[model samples]
Target: MAFFLWLPALLLAALSEPAAASAGTSICNDTGALHQLAVTARTDGSWITQGWQALAPGDCTNPLPEGYQGRFFYFRAESPGYQFRDDSIRFCTKAGPFRAGGSGDCAARGYREQAFARARISTDSQKIPLSSRSQAAAAAPDTDAAGGTPYTAAVVLQGCSPEQEGAPAACRFVGGGMEIRATAGKQAAVPAFAFLMTLQQGAPLAVEGELISSFGSHGDLDLHSAALRQPNRHDRLLRQMQGRWVSAADPGDSFTLSGAVRQVSYRGSAMPPEFVSVLDTCHGAGTAGDFLLARDSERGTGLCYRIQSLGSDELTLIYLPRGTRLVYRRLPEG
Candidate 1:
């Protein structure tokens, strides 16, 4: 039994402390699409939440009347057909132009809770620019110091035979993320397989001998390979649990856990596991000390889960509310 929690658009705003004093915050939308935005900030010793502000492509919001205070501001934005980007902070929100008084017990207080992206507002800076560009670009391999084209991560499946062996691959930065282009013949000569390719920026050129591996008959595959660097302990533990996992006591109770750059997915028999689409942004925390924030589409409520322990072939996760421990064993790969 495989269960899945769907997380649509989970966006987060980048924060920077510039040496300038401005009246209010100016939000700019750099993506070529419309975005519905929301925000939460602390003012007058209380947290205020407001929302549904819409922005057209290449447009900036009117300098909101609120001035910058030395505190963290939260924001959320989403396109018509995409997922909402949030910072894993929970705040109250309503449908129309309305304000919520406090951030506590939103539901009990007759307000709806929604996740927000957090931005620390220093007294000096007053601008928040939002874009739809690939966040992965920051982590992308930089060009050689001599000014050569940089490399980006990519994957090509084994079964996807190229129409022309050395034909140029299409590379572009799109909404979902960076995409690598390749021409595959209509027919697959082998079982469904994939190869991770390293792409050069600006051109669709792939580095030779950059193939990662071939997965036979696997469904959708997300390949993430950064330049050769020290492996993260938590990441290594997560990778060890990627395949099908079953409960030690019950075979019928099982799930599949997969991970990517800053995200993780779990599918199993549970009722849409409380946490779906866990985004890892809290840095500096070690393997078993990191925090995972959940972004659920149906319920915009923000939830946080902490990793308790991870061992060889087994993992332990504690649900924050009740401290429920879920231990799973890795199932043998078929």
Candidate 2:
């Protein structure tokens, strides 16, 4: 995971104002990991670098002394055993806590030229948020090497069975093998007769019976088994996800899915595509309407998209935080 500095710059005129005069830039550690911080800034035609400031998780420095009155400040941070880095802006730095004068000719001046990320001071003395690499990366967009949209469509689950006896209805194959009933609505308690079932389209009767016997036992059911079959479940999802999807309301927002790897390439009015991989998927422990966890393969960080409803052609996903529900339609194969 890489470290990120959220530096919102404060205008120079704002600095002279009463609010800015009393305010200074502060860095907050929003990640669970510890970090070592270094800062560089240009003041009065002289570049100065100071570093080796260690901060524990959730700790922050006091306003950094407002050492220089500059519009932009550069920062470098790293976790132990990882390489420390900044943004594209480069400056000279040392291995330990030390101050250096002049930013040019770093090698000749016995200093190392290192890249730094710019951090802007806010007028209201707001703290700059620093997140763990994984968190920052997850917020970034994904793109393919060819610079083309990877996926052509997206599908979300739709329609789930209603609850019964306060035990929550189990997902099952119904309607003369034409429809599937998936668990939906609020989460329900685990049933005493919990079972997992899978029904693939056009499967041989013998195979289907065997699956039913293996997965169907008690009266209750595990919804995960119906939507996510074992033995290459992730791979299966990856295959099903090979298409493009657009936000129903926001045409500018879209997602392109491609590759054997489970990843999502998002492009819209927000940011550039940086290709994010889907690391793994985890199921809940016998809970009805349990969240299906999808993680980043590289950083092991990801989001939990609630499986509201799932079927052969349509999928309904609900993000609880922002109350965002996305319904995706599968584009016909060409």
Candidate 3:
């Protein structure tokens, strides 16, 4: 069994698991082992506990659609025959997936009280090295030549059951099937990439590996073969794309470049935030915009983007995988 290390970016993600999409939070289980997570949080002014995110090693889960940054979130992860129970902080959790809470007697409410770890998250760049013995991690490079198998339509996120088999591929068959290799030398895009079926229609979520999987599409895909797609320009975000951006395609589908945590927040879209784990400060950073659109400054993992053009008030992005162009107009920051 590999080690389970928590990325600081995911520490605050477990907070207040709201019933609606508002509970959007992304946490990674790069511990090199499978982990089942349970959380106790306060949502909509009420305390709630949600659980069983079955995160595989090197994979992450975004339970909600939108990202939230407020108070702390609590959770516990357990693998087969192994778990870390924080006997100090206790919460009620079931054996399977569930959401429950609001001050109650464990037994009376037909619930069992379990301990949870208080995950302290901050926008600052701080990494807690969780333990790991996976040789693949020790031998892989941070960034290398990627892309072996071409990715087409069809998306498959690590489902409820993530198989640990023949070197991770872009998308594996539901039960047991052939592994679709996407890219090669993609140290980061292996068994760790979580391909959730969250695309809206034929929306394209392009990564370095040409992973073109989306709704209504079916095929084996490979994510492990590619790294962040190299943007056309090595330049950074000019004028610093802050504030809200209204999609030219659909105004209802907008994303906000939060200056607070350097985080991206989305609305009315199945796709999660483009990037997270950026610096809280907008100014005084070297690698902030080096990747053209942006990359996770803290961990360099999450999905990145390629820039078409950035005017004083507009931004254009290209979904390289499908050759789809997206334009956005910047709205005044209030």
- Top candidate on TM-score is 1
lDDT of each: 0.42, 0.43, 0.41
Comparing 1 with 3 on TM-score, the higher-scoring candidate is 1
What digit string (tens of lDDT, one per residue) describes model 3 on residues 87-117? Answer: 3677775433346876468647645666666
Please give, for residues 1-334, the per-residue lDDT of candidate 1 as tens digits. 0112222111111122232334445677776665556777677777777655555656665323445454566777655334555666788764323468777887576555667777765455455667632132324332111121122332211122332556532221211111222232223411111232332222111222111211111111122222222445433554554566665545555665433212323233343322222224322333445554443222223344566666667766655444545566776788
**For residues 1-334, what per-residue lDDT tens digits would candidate 2 score against the true structure?**
2211100011133344443243577777877766656677776687778764555667666434456567777787755333433467877764333467767887577556667778776666667667622143332332111122111111122223445778555443321101223343334423311332233332111102111111011111123222223334433554455566554554444455443222333342322222222223222223345343433222222334565655556656654333346665554555
Q: What is the C-alpha RMSD of each candidate to the true structure, in Å?
A: 16.5, 22.0, 18.2
What TM-score against the true fold does each predicted structure earn? 0.35, 0.32, 0.31
Name model 3 segments beyond 4 Å from true.
1-26, 62-69, 85-87, 124-334
CA lDDT, candidate 3, residue 230: 28
How are the candidates ranked when ordered by lDDT, highest leading? 2, 1, 3
Q: Return the candidate ranking by TM-score, descending.
A: 1, 2, 3
Cα error, residue 187 of model 1, in Å, equals 26
Question: lDDT value for candidate 3?
Answer: 0.41
Better of 2 and 3 by lDDT: 2
